[model samples]
Target chain A: MQTKRMTFSSRWLPYALLAPQVLITVVFFIWPASQALWQSMLRQDAFGLRTTFVWFRNFERLFDNPLYLASMKTTAIFAISTTLLAMSLSLLFAVMVNRMLRSREWYTTFLVWPYAVAPAIAGVLWWFMFNTSVGIVPYMLEGFGYDWNHRLDGNDAMILVVLAAAWKQISYNFLFFLAGLQSIPQSLLEAAAIDGAGRTKRFWTIVFPLLSPTTFFLMVVNVVYAMFDTFGVIHATTEGGPAQATNILVYNVFRDGFVNGNLGASAAQSVVLMGIVVVLTVVQFRFIERRVNY
Target chain B: MVENDRFGSLLAHLILILGVAAVVFPVYVAVIASTHAPGTFLQGVMPLLPGSHAIENYRTVIFEGRAQAGAPPIGLMLWNSFVMAMMIAVGKIAISLLSAFAIVYFRFRFRIFFFWVIFLTLMLPVEVRIVPTYAVVANLGLLNSYAGLSIPLIASATATFLFRQFFMTVPEEMLEAARVDGAGPMKFFKDILLPLSITNIAAMFVIMFIYGWNQYLWPLLVTNDERYYTVVMGIQRMVTGGDSEPLWHLVMATVVMAALPPILVILFMQRLFVKGLVETEK
Candidate 1:
């Protein structure tokens, strides 16, 4: 192989090429993020006008309000349960599809097709299945002498939201898991089999550990998805209905800003949400970095 | 052992078949609902089969004044969505590809710092920045315009990150070969790099298109005028009437109509979609 050292002049070319991207990122992303930080300090009147800066007053209000605390609890439950459930189901489906010899392509294609659909549309579709009056699931339950109404009950509403969120996430996690499975060397599994290891043992000792990096990546991505990206569904299906049963943090932030026009409080809530996410992400990376082989 | 393998195969097929049905069933409901008449749908009874009323319902949605009060025509909303999505798709991909190409193909000072900046942007949700972004867009006089809707979303950290990963795996020898052939940077990117990265580009395009199509909050805030509403916004208006009962069938029909183009795209490009994701793992 012929090797040539990259010269100093060549290095500057890359930076010049990257200038447009950096400029856009600064304009759209970094600048807005900093502005959000600044907005967290100010107070707004009922008319949606910023009045003055009252440092930590917004944060104080956030801690003082019972609804805000309940929303935090709701968000935690929603995020953790959905992420774990979605990841497990996707992993199982990916394994089954990977091991299948016949109709594998057909199964894989059909399974991943849902991920391509818009989240807003998925919310609409799922609402069709969960609606008390017209939904199939409720109708079926009634047929079986069981009553189910997501709109009337808080717990039922939470379960419905979690299920809807997790369903949309399964195909995303499955794609990553399938990709991870394909990248693993078959020789390692063969070696385990030759050593008289059972299928379950081989998976536990070899496949699971090797798949950790992918799993960790999926964990971070899934948490973020459950936390922030689920606004469309919450807006569509429940609209934080049955007395705010399905009101996750992002939905709360949105409702405050757009619905009630409390821009300052909403901005403060968003700042707190961002703070939690940043802390969780940092902790996740810190833990995963130690375990990640690559 | 052969018997055991056969039993396992049967089990796998059974599981996958059930999973596929669950995945496809809701979409089936949406399609069926779209075809049903308003009177039939209001009866709170769903048919297992498609109806002949799809054309009628669609005509009502499009031709009739089905828009929310203070909202634009449905056709205009769809047009807004299409134009905004296309612009965002093209802009995002161009920025991502160029940035990825730079990071992978060249060395520079503060490279790692730039990389981290990109990664950090992914963690900052739109909720965090909406207040500031709203002000920024207002200040720039981009309110109620296609440029206002599209420009703020022109850069995406996820696309850039994905493309960078893809670019890292491109063979260095190909670039060196092009250089030795006396190809300049522009020729090298145009002829050698872009051609080799076509699949990745297509994959990124589909992903970005979906992202732009589904955007709601930013557009909702920045573009107050009904003329700039996207399809998602239009659907939301139909579903949420204050005192009047929402037309469920019409809403589902609009939802289904909005979803059709993307579904068709996915169906035709299924292989590329899977291939794109698979390559990301490498």
Candidate 2:
């Protein structure tokens, strides 16, 4: 809420400046969102004619629907696993890269470029790598008496998507974790070393605790990411396939709306997603406020 | 890090090298795959080494495209992607900059209201509200156009907030000094503020460019016309567009093409990319 102490008096100029953003937001963001809210309360016939207004019927049916409930569960699993896998792997790499005196930048440059690869591209690459007939991972897994076919097995499909999602995200998490690790003053580690604490002990007692804020921030981001951003990861490879095994909420909204042409259900899903996003945004801002105060 | 522990340093390097290999291997495989002939993929496990057909595959995919897949040339799609990325990036930075300046410099009624309106955008990503947003765009007859691709994606909340935060940190004396020098607000902004904000702007440019380029679902939905296809979405077509299994060689070639620009941006402007990403998100 802070502004310049010596401020400009021109009222019209400010509105003019704000006009473009406000226009785009209202037309594209707000109008569509409100349309979703409004349409969620209505039902249309299968023929897309004679719509009838129904109060909360779409949402009520959505909760009662098994597939909708399943997607929420899938999103939870996918988001949590992707966050864990990405954060831990990146944290380990960050910690190790942080220790290197000479090859730190070299390793970092090598590690961070994956952030640039598009998620859809990342998914395709992994999908190719895990392609059952000729994939290297499957070829290797077959040696261990396990047949890896993402196209058929729901759990395998989930793992494939998770791995793809996590792989694309590792570079992002690495950069932040590296920044967090770098920001930790060396004097504290030196102090801990002098106190006869071993490396592992120092990391647990000193490094891990200091990195919590970064960890929490990345957790929220990665969850939001896995929820929404991994649409390409699903669409390009799985297409939410085999069953509804990998259909996260965003993809479901798309499928239900565009593919299924179930306007009512899709609109309801969009409204629900809007509510989720509002909650997440509020949570993130609250944490940000707390962090600023601290 | 504080102690000179040789064993620990050695162990750290070893772990880091392994991590780097793991990170690079997929792309390496992609690169290797792009070099082979079409028959190479169908023969079973893809060969790990480079093949002689590299130029032939790259040349075909970039210029001719896979005709059977009904996709346009990678050259055209790459150009489309570039144009869209530039528009989205520049448009976002321009609008966000103006709005942030307006909020920071002027004390106006409903300023807080306007800020919240902009802030609300952060909650609703395009993925969450695709149906209704698409309907709105369709209503405007903006579908299958560059404006359709970029405009809806350009109103960024984080960029606006970042500029606002940066503007706040700028010392108030600069404004007072500019006022004393008989300089107007716009004049002061162009002369002083823009120069100071170059780094932030460049950093934001890197982030937004990648974001715009990496977009998949939005472009996929809007631009159904082959002429408007972007390489990122076009690659998906090469995979699923044809009746037969995808021509892995050309598909990989297109993948490499689609990924190369943003990857190069990250490689060259890593500091800015890191700054923009961390600062914007955090």
Candidate 3:
């Protein structure tokens, strides 16, 4: 909210400067979002001819519908699992890499490039590796007498999508964790070591606790990511298939809106997603404000 | 130094090696897969090592796309992706810089309103409001065009906030000095601000370029025409477009190409990428 004290008093120039961003936001972002809210309340007849304004009908039916409810539960699970898997793995890698003296940058270079790979591409790569027919993972799993088929088995499909999603996210989480780990003062750890703490003990007592702020921040980010951004991960590989096992909310919004052409229902879903995003954004900004104070 | 635990250092190296291998495994497999002939993927587990047909497979995908799958050649899709990425990156940065400068340097009417409007965009990612947004673009007849591919995605709150944050850190003396020198706001911005912001701009360019290149669903929705198909979305089409199992060799080749540019960007400009990413979060 703060601006420079010595400010320029401009009439048309500031307005002109702000025009392009404001125009795009209103036309592309705000107007469409408002339309989504409006349309969520209106339902069209099967023939696509007559439309009726049904108050809360779409949202009511969505909650009552078993599939929508299942999709909500599926999204919760997928988001949580992906966040945990990605954060923990990256935390471990960050911790290990943080300890290295000579090879730290080398290891980081190897781990961080995957952040550049598209989620959809990441999904495809994993899908190929776990391909039911000839994928390497399935072949390796077959050695343990486990039949790996994502097409038919819902659990297999969920696991496959999670791996793909988590795999793509690891690099992002790794970078943040590395930065966070690097920021921690070495003096504290050395003090703990002087108290006869073992490395494991020191990590639990000193390192992990110190990294909590970063952990909490990454948790929110990874959750938002798994919820929204992993649309590609689901779309490219699973297509919300095997009885909609991996159909996260964002993908469902896309499938219901664009693919199935259920406008009212999809609009309602979009509104719901917007509400979730609003909450998440508020939480993120609130945490950021708190961090700034710290 | 902490306790000199030789065993601990050894364990750290061992763990890091495994972690690196795990991180690189999928792409390594993709590269190895791209090198093989089509027949190699049909019968058994994917081979771990590189194959002899790398050139042929890369050539096939780059030049001659699988017509049956309806995917365009990789060469064209890669160009499309590059153009889209550049537009989104440069457009977002330019507009954001202007708007941030406006907000920071000038006290105008409805300034807070405009800041909040830009802030609202963070909550409305394309995924949430895809249907209505697509309708708006379609109404404007932007479908299957580069403008459609990038413009809708270019209005960025993160970039604006980044510039705003950076602008606040800039010493006020620069502005006062320029004002005393009779240089107007625009002149001062172009002369002083832009030069000072080059590093932040470069860092943001790295991040946004990757974000734009990695886009999948938006491109998938707007472009039914093959000409506008980006490599990221094009890979999805190659996998699911054909009835028969995808030509793994060529598909993997395209995958390598699609993921290469952004990966190389990060590898080469890692410091900038990290700075952009970490600062954007802040």
Candidate 4:
């Protein structure tokens, strides 16, 4: 809410400056979001002939439907697994890269370009690598007398999508983790080392605690990303198939509304997603506000 | 150093090497796949080494797209992707810059309200509100055009917030001096503020260009016309070609081409990309 001390006294210029952004927000963002909320309460009969106002029935039906509940469970598993897998590996990489004096830039350069690959492209790459016939990973798995086919196995499909999603996200989490590692005061670590604390003890007792704020922030971001931004990963590789094994909530929304024409259900699902996003955004911003003190 | 730890240093180096290999393995496989002939994928495991058909595969995809896959030429799709990314990056920056300037430098009514309105955008991502938003765009008849590709996506709260944060650190003396010289508001903004913000803008450009280029769903939703297909979405079409297994070589070639631009952008402007990325989250 702060502004410059000496400000411009303009009646029209400020409004003019704000007009374009406000216009686009209202037209493209606000109006559509409000419509989704409103449409979640309305139902259309088969053939789109009769429209009936049914308040909360759509939401109630969504809760009762087993598939919706199943999709919710699928989403939670995907988001949590992806977040953990991406964060832990990135943290390891960041710690190792942080130890280097001369080769840090080279290692970082090698690690960070994958952040630029789109989620859909990342999915395609991994899908090809795990393709049943030509995939190297499956071929290696066969050496251990194990079969790998995401097309038929639900667990295999989930693992495939998680690996794809987490793969694309590692570079982002790495950069953040590296930045967080760099920001920790070296004097504190040195003091711990001088206190007869070994490297392992020094890291757990000093460095890891200092990195908690960054970890929490990245957790919220990774969850949000795994939930919403992964539509492309699902769409491109799986299309939420193998008996809807990989159908997360956002993909469910698109599939129900666009592909299956279940408008009210999809809209209801969208509202639920918006609620999740609001909670996550609030958590993220609150953590950010508290981050200054740390 | 506190202690000589040659063993620990060696362990760190070994872990980093393995980590880097894990990270590069997928893309390495993709590049290897792109170089092989189409028949190389039909009978056995994908080849680990590059083949002589690299130029042939790249040329076939770039110049003549696989008609069986319903994909247009990669060259046209790449052009569309570039145009869309540029428009989105430039448009978001322009509008957000003006709005952030207004919020920082001018006293206005409903300022807090407008700020909150813009902030709400951070929560409602395009995926959650996909249906209604698509309806709005379709209602406005913007389905298959450049404007449809970028304009609806141009209003960015992140850029606005970043610029506002940058503006707060500017010394108040600059504005006071500009006023003493009788410079108007727009003039001061153009001459002084814009110059001061060049580095931030360039950093933001790197981030936003990558962001805009990597978009898949928005482009897929808006453009059904082959003339407007972006390379990212076009790759999906190639992979999902009806019934038969996709032509792995050409598909990998298209994938490589699709992912190259933004990767090059980040590599070339890594410092700015890192700065923009770390600061924007705050």
Write one digit per residue (lDDT tens) for candidate 3, span A176-281. 9999988989889888888899889988988899888899899999999999999899988989989999988998999898878999999999999999999998
- Which portions of model 2 miss their true places by more than 4 Å? none
Separate clash counts for every candidate: 0, 0, 0, 0
Question: Which residue runs of candidate 3 sit more than 4 Å off their true CA positions?
Answer: B67-69
Which pairs clash (backbone N, Cα, C closer than 3 Å) in model 2? Answer: none
Docking class of 4: high
What lDDT does each candidate get? 0.77, 0.91, 0.92, 0.93
lDDT of 2 by residue, B1-282 (tens): 556788878887788878888888888989999899878878889888999999998889889885644677889999999999999999999999999999999999999999999999998899878989999999999999999999999999999999998999999999999999999878988898899999999999999999999999999999889889999998888888757778888888889999999999999998899999989975
Pairs that clash in candidate 3: none
Docking class for model 2 is high
Report how closely model 4 matches the true complex, as a DockQ value. 0.91
Model 4 misplaced stretches (Cα beyond 4 Å):
none
Q: Rank order by TM-score, top first?
A: 4, 3, 2, 1
Better structure of 2 and 4 per TM-score: 4
State which candidate, 1 or 3, has the greater DockQ. 3
| lDDT, candidate 2, A101-154, per-residue tens | 778888889989989899999999998899876678998898899988887899
So what's the TM-score on candidate 1? 0.90
* lDDT score at residue A182, model 3, on the 0-100 scale: 87
Off by over 4 Å in 1: A1-4, A7-16, A45-50, A187-206, A283-294, B1-3, B65-73, B104-113, B169-183, B278-282
The residue pairs in collision within model 1 are none
